[model samples]
Target: MRCNVAPHTFRSSPYFHLTRPLTRRSLKSIEDGLINAQHLDDQIPTELAPGNAAVLIPLANVMDVPGILLEVRGKMMRNHSGEVSFPGGRVDATDSSYVEAALRETREELGIGAQDIEILGQIGPPEVNLRGNMVVYPFVGFVHAGSSHSDHTNTVALDEPLPSCDLDAIRRNASQTEVDAVFHLPLSALTSPARLRASMFRGNRPYWAIGVQDLVSDIPASFKGRMKQIEHDDVDDSEIGPGKYGNLEVWGLTGWYLYLLMKKLKLYY
Candidate 1:
């Protein structure tokens, strides 16, 4: 379920300066972190049958710029509408494993198939009872933008590479019904020390979260106050967003994922 591109190949690409290889040590750490996260295990309850869900953390060198694939959900959706997120949804009963559900949801959301992706493995245990509705399983993997084809066959290669910032290749294959737009943020952006900031919850279980400043600047002045409201309540769209800012809004669970992944890659401490 995993695939590896030659380290030299990734290094030689135009995006080499912006991207680093996902090393074996980091991959092992990611798996170990998830497996050993006692806090994640504690979130599940014995009586509740967790509603399983999965998401794919797809990374790739697109037109020589290494970036991660993310989706802007359609505004008409019932939940998390118009939010940026990894491609995935609930694991249907027919699915055999978390891997299957992740790949299936990815295919449904982005038209990406198992053949095009090299599944790296799981990250952390299922983030259980999220918003009190479902348990989410996150998987990290590599996606090759050059290998994309309308038919899901690997034979077709692009006549010309896409521009580094363009997302048309991915958008062309995405499901318009579920996705309003598709975008890629250079993986290099997350490692910047200056753009990152942190805030303390200062509650009973006081914790700190890292976020990109200016990314959520439009959030109402009451944003921190709202935190107290939902600190122990089920999440709803009313609490979904301060909305997207110009720069990619990588925060909350998604930001935490980047923090852990980048830390494991040794890009950040």
Candidate 2:
């Protein structure tokens, strides 16, 4: 891993040229920027106030590349059932800060804890959506897997740790009660031209969405069929609500935050 590579160099890096393989050096650079980055004040809408909700964007510690964790909400979920999203929920009153809320929700949903995460930074200013009457703060963090870096790994097992950073491990770790399925998306694929499509919400607001093929291998059998159903142009009706970008639809306010995150990482323009 190159210790001194700058984020700007990513534009010309071999990583992008070779089918979007994310290297450790590239992830390190992203982490460095996030730690020191200022909040995105302008991007956050002002109509809504800071609320008691947050989400964790968890990046994994794969050797050559890192992957992000996402959840498919259980079919029984009251809101957004079977939807893909970051692992998080409304902040509890006992929680001290938004960070704690994120970690706690992650623990409840994915079995990840604050001890396992090295918080890079909050991706954007608090996200405020008038439609849902919610304001959510987004936290970017890394979950250490094994012995790569002692400082990064949480050796003290707090409750049985969710071992194995593989695809199957991610799927098995997801709580059946909360998550229908779990999948890991390589950081590189988030910005791939072939995997991205420009989508519009409310027939005006535009954001980027990811295609099913962009997923980092091992998609569940159930999700594959849904992905194919949404791959075409039949569900473009804004009046019907959020549109899918293949099966893994990343849209609505969640899509907005994803766009902000991609820009923050210099992965997407």
Candidate 3:
């Protein structure tokens, strides 16, 4: 199937684009900025293991509204039940590489075929949750423009409504699960100040916030109320409420990956 998403306007912020090529001096400057900003914590022990996993960050083309595709797992699933995440799983013996595993699982979960996706690059190898100490390799892939899939497919028909939006789906999915929900947040969100905030959590508690940019001022009142209700419920369970304007406080491995990616790309605002 061909992905037929509309084209969304994406601009590179002046803050994000460096004037010169990244040299050792420039790299050191960037690292120093992060260190001085107190964003680096070297105390956490690095846990590297052999288990492999993968996830596809599916991008849809929408006019002035590029978005990432995200899935909400059935609550009955064994691990990360009801969590909002990218469609992926552990590497099977038949899978040749982590990239292959990601593409295959995305095909299985979203009815997105291997031929329809263009692999961009990788982000990180974070720790996996349920698979007895497995490392997850996340790859960025772009769904072919104008691609279309049917409702009759086994994947889309079984999963709940697959939302494609600018970071809103991430917040909504995380709010529903009350656990660390995986997300491929847009680079645009990290460029604005009003849409971003820094959060501090209890000792070693992973916490970071990714604010949304260019949000419509008049969001439907009903949707706003529903979001409040979801936040209230999550708060009762000791999880942070859905953040301002329905943005999420990314935590755990998700937050770590985002942090690292932002640092590496020098894109954080």
Best by TM-score: 2
lDDT of 1 by residue, 1-269 (tens): 11121122111222123554443333344445444543553333323233767778887555566667777666566776655577888777767777778889888888887776766555554554346677766777766444442232334233322223235766778887787667666766664544443421111111112233243223322332223323322222221232223233454455555544444444444
Error of 3 at 202 (Å): 11
**For residues 1-269, could you state the per-residue lDDT of candidate 3 as single tens digits?**
12121222123422223222222233234335434433233221233224666767665433323345554444445564433356787778777777888898876666567776656455643444533466566666555432333221224322222223334433443433222233444445544445444442222332344443223233333223324333221211112233443443333344445544554445532
Greater TM-score among 1 and 3 belongs to 1
Residue 209 of model 1: what lDDT?
Answer: 29
Model 3, residue 181: what's the lDDT? 32
- Per-residue alpha-carbon lDDT of model 2 for 1-269, expressed as tens digits? 11121223224332222233333454455667665555547242323334557888887734335567777777666766656778888866667777788889987888765676767667767655455666678887767564333443334332222233555655667688787777666666665666556665434445566554345244444444444335543323231112354445555556667666666655554
| Model 2 score (lDDT) | 0.59
lDDT of 1 at 191: 47
Q: Report the backbone clash tally of model 2.
A: 0
Q: In model 3, where do residues sit more than 4 Å from their true spots? A: 1-51, 128-132, 147-186, 192-207, 211-250
Alpha carbon deviation, residue 5, candidate 1 (Å): 34
Number of clashes in every candidate structure? 1, 0, 18
Better of 2 and 3 by TM-score: 2
Looking at model 1, report the run of 10 residues with the lowest lDDT sum.
199-208
Q: What local lDDT score does residue 109 receive in model 3, on the 0 to 100 scale?
A: 65
